[model samples]
Target: MTRLERKCPICGKPRAAEHTPFCSKRCRDRDLLQWLEDGYALPGPPSFPDNPQDD
Candidate 1:
């Protein structure tokens, strides 16, 4: 059986062993920056305040 090729999520380039899911340091860092700056997010319900007056 042939092995499936892994690709970088940040770019379409083939993944590097060192970076695993990313091709290079640049792509890895870029992904991290995206998370840090809230460029990525998870779906969730609206948060409610413990106290209505807090709003």
Candidate 2:
């Protein structure tokens, strides 16, 4: 494998030039969907509003 070529992030198949890092459109779409659905999360402290809402 070349320096740029690697297994797909989602399926472990050889990645395609058209879809770098992913093997196919299906894998690419799956990754996007995961982002859209909040399936991927960044590690951080819980966020709170600057102004506390008094109930």
Candidate 3:
């Protein structure tokens, strides 16, 4: 197993095995809520072309 210290994106706490990238269940749930509320978003358009015929 690897040992790495990463700050949680949700609460900015130290990450652990149980949460992984999140510090705890609460932070994980908070991140999920943010995602559900559209706080996070895709940066660009879909990979496929709008018109397949054009490709």
Of candidates 3 and 2, the better by TM-score: 2
Give the candidate number with the greatest lDDT: 2
Tell me the whole-model lDDT of each prediction, alpha carbons only.
0.84, 0.87, 0.82
Query: Each model's TM-score?
Result: 0.74, 0.74, 0.64
* Candidate 3 residue lDDT tens string, 1-55: 3457668877677887888878899999988898999998888987888899986
User: Distance (Å) between predicted and true CA of 21, model 1?
Assistant: 0.6
Candidate rank order under TM-score: 2, 1, 3
Q: What does candidate 2's lDDT look like per residue over 1-55, in tens digits?
A: 7746678989999888898788899999999999999999989865775667842
| Candidate 2 Cα outliers beyond 4 Å, as residue runs | 1-5, 48-55
Q: Per-candidate RMSD vs. true structure? A: 3.4, 3.4, 4.3
Q: Count of backbone clashes for each model? A: 0, 0, 0
Model 2 RMSD, rounded to 1 decimal: 3.4
Cα misplacement distance, residue 24 of candidate 2 (Å): 0.6
